[model samples]
Target: MTDASTVIAKPVSQNRAIWQQFRTHRGALFGLIVLGVLAVVVLIGPYLWIPEKLSVAEAIKLKNQGPSWRFPLGTDQLGRDMLARMMLAGRISLAVGLVAMTIAILFGTLIGVLAGYFRRLDGPLMRLTDMFLALPLIPLLLVLVMLFRDRVASIIGPEMGAFALIVFAIGITSWMSTARIVRGEVLTLKEREYVLAARSIGARPHRIILRHILPNVISPVMVSATLEVANAIITESVLSFLGLGFPPDFPTWGRLLFDGLQYMQVYPERVIWPGLAISLTVLSVNYIGDGLRDALDPRIRGR
Candidate 1:
């Protein structure tokens, strides 16, 4: 017979249990490792391998050279060190994705929670969401950029202004889907016993949402956040490819792709590097989202 002390199982905290479930997903584990490694490289690699500080003549002399011991990724047409540029570009790309996703998640959650909790407001708020959904995303982005890019650039200087506009554009356009998902979840949650119990106790709407609704809905929101990051990165890349993003001098992954397009025939690696980076980053984020969805769901967490 087992001793009572030995038979008794210690309880696991919610966070610890969730982490255990998350770790069980091999794809998620791999994605997390890859993303962490990339983040470290982008953060520290630039200092070790400085990019494009050579004099104009010296830079010109190094143009179009293949990778060597000095330049591990080869020099671009303008003779900037490819490795350094890549690190800098990764920083910007990741920043854009994270910041934009934050904005989208915040706004979407607000809209979703409000609409889901208040039956009186649901029709109008959902209709508004529908209106946004009906709009063509790419065309709207182009128009927003064309109309505001020059004015914003003049006010804040080109690089910062462009970053702000792109982030804003992607954030607003991407929130609709998240809103719909969250709203659906909230609608189901609000009718649950705990939410109804909070209502009976004279808790305010805001308090009820904060204490009960948001916590319950976080799983889906996290999944949406991951997808938003991937989408924002791709959108930024497209804008840069079209020459509508950051100025030519400020390197982003997308801009790097555009610059390398001309040299593709002679030095295909120029395009391959950035393209591969974008694809792998997006793929990793998608895997992470898939894992989070499974780990966060009450029904699936243990199974």
Candidate 2:
């Protein structure tokens, strides 16, 4: 008679063990700390205080103002507070990155798991995934943006429309890598003794996948997700800078870059701030992803 308490405790104990192992990786620990700080800043900084509404006339005064006591980062061409706008923009950029990556990860994991577990589906599914992989993402995204501009604006309103488009574009394109990674992991895991045991016990396919396979495959998925966030963010910035991103009324980091590019010769700092923000955020995310990969893989740890 298996004790229910013991059965529940086993999973909790296993989770704790994994966490303990993860903590031992120094780079991952550092990355976590940095990411935590950045996340807090992005989430809380905008809500602490509100910026005064500047009429188009009043907004003209601070245009291209360099770093000073009044404005820490400086004012943009529109006279909007650079620091305030940067922080505000961070919210949108980060949100899109996380949400888009989450969509990709969820869909990719589902496809990968199904394909890997059912051998008959593997060839066709993988080839389809390969097709997406083969297509050029940036050009496709540009075409989609142009083709669906009016429809997207009507659906989500101007403020959120561009963000949503960026998310969809990134999510659809980014899943290929995740699917490939998850497929490989699932293939190896599905053949393990525990999976065979579960099958022998009359566990349904869904139950076996959920209970036995998902746990083992989740580590790589997590690493992929972290890295994809950075990719998505960069993609959003590129789109925005090309004047295809969020409308002027609602600014994002990429939009700032676009606005700043005009004044780069007169006030280079306008371009610098947003560029730095994007670079730093992406760099930090990549570092964290690297850490997660190292921490999650025993082979890397052993090496």
Candidate 3:
């Protein structure tokens, strides 16, 4: 029987090993820190500044004002606070990306696990996932957004229409990669000795999957989910810029960039700010994802 001291020491040792692995990748470590800082600023910084309310009219000021001590990033054409809007908008954009990816991961894992574990279902399940993969994602999103604009708005309200659209669009298309990855992992894991041992021990199929299979396979799924956040955010921005996303009243980084596009020649900063935001956010996420992939995989660590 394990003593209390032994139990406590085991987790501590495991955590130290994980940290050692994570610390080995300098770029990933930096990316992790950047992501953590950005997430905190986006989630908590805005509330501290404007706890009273979020008013469009009140937030607006001198239009096209260049970066000043007061405005920092400067005001938009609508005279809204650029910095404030950025902070606020980050919350929505990041939230949409995360939530959408979560939905995709959950759904994809379910389908992949079932298809891999059940030999009979593999062909049909994979075929359907392939169909989605075969289609052009952007054009399909465009058509879906146009067709379901009103219905989507009705369900989630006008304020959240763009966010909802981004979530749904990304969720649907993003799952294909996850499904494929999970399927591959599950197929390999299902063949392992532990799985056969679990089966021989009178473990039900569900118990075998939950207790033995998912644990070994979930690392790749986590990395895929992180990378998907960047993809979903970029896709949302693209849709919003095309005017197929949120209304003018709702300000996301994409819509801000769209509004600034007309003034690109006159006021390039307008375009620059939002574009930079999108680029940095996506880059940071991707870097972190790469880091996680290396950290979790022992083969990569050796290199």
Candidate 4:
């Protein structure tokens, strides 16, 4: 009989190995550190910085000001503090990315598992996935926002309504790729000996899927989630830049970009700040995902 310590030790060793593999990827390690730093700064920044409660007349005095000890990042065209705005925008953008990815992963996993596990569901669900894949993503998102934004804004307050609409639109639309990946993984996993053994024993489908299939498929799902976060951020940015995402007064990285566009020639830093934030964030997430894909796969990890 196996000892309890042996079982525990084996898992610990395996996790250590996986972490070692992840660390070997320099890009991934860098991304992890950068992301951590960004998260911490954004979370604590507003409390520390304390944006001034300025009236329009007072705000006008600070408008178009360059960086100084007073405002490290400088002031925007409207005299808003760039550093404070950056921290706030980072919080919103990161929140959107994480929330949207969660929605996509949950929905995609459900559809993919059902389609892959049950023979009856395979064809129809796959076809539905295909139909969604064929549609133009930007156009569909635009249509969704146009159709529902006003009604949603009315039901909830405008800010929250826009947030929900943007997150849902991005999440629902982005799941097709994840669904396809998960379906393929599930198809292969269902044919494995353990799964066949579970089926032969008359285990319920739900039980088998929960106990066996889902755990096996988690690696791919985790990798997909990272990519989904980047996709969601970029999508939200696009919508905001187009002036359809959030209310004008509500600042997001995308909104900052939109506002800075007109000032691009004169105050180029206005455009640069938000643009760099978006680009670096997306790139970091993609690198992290790439590293995770390698670290999570046994074959690659072993190498």
lDDT, each prediction = 0.91, 0.84, 0.83, 0.92
- Residue runs of model 3 more than 4 Å from their true location after superposition: 1-12, 50-61, 300-303
Query: Superposing all C-alpha atoms, what RMSD in Å does each candidate have to the true structure?
Result: 1.6, 5.0, 4.3, 3.4
Question: lDDT tens string, model 2, 239-299?
Answer: 8899987887677789999988878898888888889888878887887787777667767
Displacement of residue 210 (Cα, Å) in model 4 is 0.3
What is the descending lDDT order?
A: 4, 1, 2, 3
* Better structure of 3 and 4 per lDDT: 4
Residue 129 CA error for candidate 1 (Å)? 1.6
Against the true structure, candidate 4 reaches a TM-score of: 0.95
- Give the TM-score comparing model 3 with the true structure, all chains together: 0.89
Better of 1 and 4 by TM-score: 1
Clashes found in each candidate (C-alpha, N, C closer than 3 A): 0, 0, 1, 0
* Model 3 residue pairs with clashes: 61-79
Candidate 1 least-lDDT 10 residues: 45-54
